[model samples]
Target: MDIEIAFGQPRPWTETVAWGPYRARHADLFEFVMPGVARYTLEDRSRVTVTPEDGADEAPIGEMLVATVLPSLIWARGDVVLHASAIARPGQNAGLMFVGASGSGKSSRLQRAVGRNARVIADDSARVYLQDGELLASGLPGGMFIRTHDAADSRTLVSVPPEQQLKALPVTSMLILGNDDSPVRRLTGVEALASLLRHRHRPRILRLLGTEADFIGPLGDIAARLRIAVVGVRAWMP
Candidate 1:
């Protein structure tokens, strides 16, 4: 495992940056307090400690660890945690990613891809980083969380899971979800770069951590290599 998770009391912060009652960070350790749920401590991108609160069980806390805590740790570092979902064809290691604002149907499109026998690379928060002169994505294995009848409620769709361990996969295709007039249009040069920057996870955290500049080195390469395009709902063909 790339990260180790433990349940215990978190250590106190030496220097703290608190944005609100729920968010705070210091050095390489990050803290998230989900009122009455759990207190999560993400340290140095490798370990997370969950301290239960208000008699909360391990299930919900563990869920939040994957959903929010893990992503936050990835974002805190120089790497890019995208607001995206991805799937790759059987026998193919590379992925086709769907990226855009949250609730822009990334989850639904991911579901559709699953129905077609595509393997899920990431459900919502796609962890991408540069390694060995290429952009590699982590196959974050877990249930596919999608919205249900109620806007506030979510349901997990079980599909063929990725390998039990985390491994990197190439992402050669990317689609930017939007309300464009065209059915599908490939982006290039400045257009593609702009679209990618707008879809990264939690820009606010980058701003807070002052590591936005750290990812600049990889952004250009990702935009240049991936065949990114703007596609509307139901426009994805093959």
Candidate 2:
């Protein structure tokens, strides 16, 4: 089997790896090679060769593979994968990203912002890339998901099925939703760095790769170039 993703340019694959109901291909969509012993082969720019290992059931593997590979594919095409939610609008050069623990109101705030006319660049994950030294945020193929009860009340909001809602957004402005009722405020220097560190992706993975320092350098650069904030909500809006 084969899968193709067209992001302005065509990426084709021909290797087949069956996992659960999904089969993944080693197409040109990947910029980095698969880490570890997960076998894969690329054929006809459209198919992948997949051999399931013992205990490696299909469903989890399929989900893990996509999550691991999609970002590299997106980055290969000159996009940055941010672990946050993003929103933007006309006249704004960059967007805002909200990141926090699950049920932290990140999506709810973004929904509110969208209702206020902010264009959603991405709901859960934001794709950011630097062009001519300027960071720009772009939308992913998904949208934010709210609860069914909230969904009915937010008919005017741009939403999608719960399963398809995103949890990451491109990094423009990093907002950490505080549990308290304090007002929102901008953070810089150490405060900003601490906040970003709290939300870094796969912290253990980076440590194992010995890339923690390398990762921090770039994150610091991003923090310096973009706005970072922590906002407090009075209640569980969602």
Candidate 3:
């Protein structure tokens, strides 16, 4: 769906970006207006409106559009959002999602896979859901966001098509990346559920907005349907 993001006159409010009650106005309604980023209004469960920060260039607006606004949009659609990177084998339609905490090498590992002929699916955020008993991964239009320093070594990430977003890649497996040197290990249902919940993205706005009730059921279903495993560098060793 094409979302229209029209610039609006600034709302007269304190300017702050801290993730706290005071920094955000209309907290009770789950709406946020970041000073130098963008303003987000969760109109309802399925609709959101965004206005770019005043005087911002295309890059910042685009960044916030993907990192902040897009996730909110995906959440509104009732899909389980993940703080992870995903990749698919070359010429294949299915992919595996690799999730981990910040600094856990999720993106780096996925880039390594890209060097070995895997296609970059989603770099940092993914919208995953079960469709007709098959798990799938969906991404937005922006290319993978590679740190400036890592650009020298990134293969597919070096030149991602801005308009090319993976519509859907059936998810055949899930991996939890870590720093450990151990080989891959399958996680039990309970473990996978806990891991999924831990890495899933739900903005702080969901707190006072009282939308957790809508997500609990779908998350449980995702955990039950997908097989999850924990892996480390060894799993990617040649």
Candidate 4:
């Protein structure tokens, strides 16, 4: 339940960090390496062990936690975590979520949603779970998808998390945001499953941990009840 930071004494990686970012080990333990930050090990889906790179700043470590580490832990615990964003509007009963792969415009749409004064349930890596047969989403502590042009690169995003702890909000609709000409359409059955599977956070680790197949039933229920659609990037408030 705590992050143990280690220096000098590094955990051995079977493969080089550059070539191997993720290693599929025993179901109880998982270890991964990320450049420009630190090496991370998820212990039994409960605790985190971090090995910072030489002179690595704590800022990058915090960013990587929200980016991958935290979500990996949540995903390992059997929750349906997606590299997606969620937003809720006033007087609305259910929140809306946007899901897509990297560079699919999910973040841009999220920035726009926040600009519209919509309440942010989560930014990237929306942690979803079932509560009494109802699907709900809870944002990670530092949940906000914001890219700073002044930063090192175009992919560098700074997250300003909420001031207080966030609560899980019911989700009734999900949209796959894309720039393509794909008409706005509802996805169901195999289509929904396939789309959702593609955007799962750290799917390789989940598959290695033998929990990927466990999502079929839960995802089916989520897709069947919720309005999962594919919306073009130009279309908003869809």
Candidate 5:
């Protein structure tokens, strides 16, 4: 099946990505040569392709392919895509997402939650959209990378062979990470809207969509229906 994904910018590649039993519509971003295989050509005349070893499972490469493709799709669909880690309950009763810049421990906290048996919704980046009367957090294409103070100790946690781990999960709450020693807290109404807009992937999109005028209203509605918060985790014991 050929899945055509539209994008805001012209696709850099003129080729199609072929995977096992499936072919993906490629634009300029990147392309996958097979299941779990990816090729990215940089302007510096360098190309990087992620391919699985012989007889190895192709799921990881497949995931990389989706990660490369899904964000653009979500952006084109007019939904917000943010860099964050998210978790949801098994029955989907409520969910939470953490967003931040690199080294903010977004993935670390997510991995920690896995130890606590919290069902991971997504890692690295998540796509949020509204369906029916509720804002649903859904899993996107990318995987999470675990970083630990001790490289050796990281292995004990979500160990995927070959020393690299990647898994897909669902997203529920929208939590922006900021440095603080205060306890975790939920945000609602104007506070929630402010938090979301502050961390939104593309603020210009809001203006473009003409949703800027009512952005706070929609975000407040979503926050009320779902769980949203800003969490502060300390590096040292309290």
Candidate 6:
């Protein structure tokens, strides 16, 4: 585990963004306060404290920990995390990834592939890194958060039973989902990295943490080597 979580008392902090139950700030330290739920304080984005609110349930808090807090820690650890989804071919260590704006069918296409026997790698975010000059991805801890009804029929749709998480897999291909006029098209290195940057998780936070250089270094390296392409119903074909 790259991050450690523990129960602790909530500390007072300035509000950065207050919307509904979520109040957040990132000054000396990053903190998220969920009224009547949980207050999370990430110390240097390394150690996380989960302070449960009165009468709060564990499921939602756990979800936030896995979905939001962990991703922040991943970035703090100098890794590149993206708002993407992926799946690996069954019985193989290699994986294929799909990236695009929300509602661009990243999840939908991945679900289609999952129905055809691809193992779920990630649902909404992909934790990526470079290992021995190869790009790799690991499943984030959580079930595949599906927004469409068709995904309900996927074989892997069992609500991420706590023990059924996947391990890291070598990412062999990437697809930039869009409504291009071609079926599929290869992306130049510049185009590929641009797409990656647009999907980077907490890109703004990376800059505030002064880690943008670290994040882009590996991203460029990965983009330079991967078989990147753009795919749509009429997308550019490689």
Best by lDDT: 1
| Whole-model lDDT, model 2 | 0.52
RMSD of 5: 9.9
Judged by whole-model lDDT over C-alpha atoms, candidate 1 comes out at: 0.72
Candidate 6 residue-wise lDDT, 54-148, digit = tens: 88988778767766777767776777888877777667778877787766666556656556666777877788887887788886634676665
What's the lDDT of the predicted structure labeled candidate 3?
0.65
**Stretches of model 6 off by over 4 angstroms after superposition:** 10-28, 34-37, 55-57, 148-165, 233-238
Which consecutive 10 residues in model 2 have the weakest lDDT in total? 1-10
How many residue pairs clash in all the candidates, one count each?
0, 26, 0, 0, 11, 9
| lDDT tens digits, residue span 1-238, model 2 | 1245322222444434443332334323222233332434333445334544455555544443444444433433333456666765434545667787866677667777666666666654455555577766655534455534554434222444444333333445666778788877889997787776776533433332233565566667667877877777663232
Quick one: RMSD of model 6? 4.7
Flag the better candidate by TM-score, 3 or 4: 4
Please give, for residues 50-69, the per-residue lDDT of candidate 4 as tens digits: 87888788877877877788
| List of clashing residue pairs for candidate 3 | none
For model 3, where is the 10-residue window of minimal lDDT?
21-30
Candidate 5 deviant stretches above 4 angstroms:
1-69, 89-92, 148-172, 202-220, 235-238
User: Candidate 5 residues 24-69, lDDT tens each?
Assistant: 3422233323433443221111223343445645555445445444
- Show the colliding residue pairs in model 6: 181-234, 182-234, 182-235, 183-235, 184-235, 184-236, 184-237, 185-236, 185-237
Model 2 residue runs over 4 Å out of place are 1-69, 72-80, 90-93, 139-141, 147-172, 234-238
- Listing every candidate in turn, what is its Cα RMSD in Å to the true structure after a full C-alpha superposition? 2.7, 9.1, 4.6, 3.6, 9.9, 4.7
Better of 1 and 3 by TM-score: 1
The per-model lDDT (C-alpha) reads: 0.72, 0.52, 0.65, 0.71, 0.51, 0.70
- Which structure among the candidates has the greatest TM-score? 1
> How do these models rank on lDDT, best leading?
1, 4, 6, 3, 2, 5
lDDT per residue (tens digit) for residues 1-238 in model 1: 3678888897777535666534556537767788878888778868888888978866677667777777888876667777787777756768778886655676777667666777776776788777787777774645677767676555555544555223457789898887544688899988887877897866666765667787776777788888998888667743
Ranking by TM-score: 1, 4, 3, 6, 2, 5
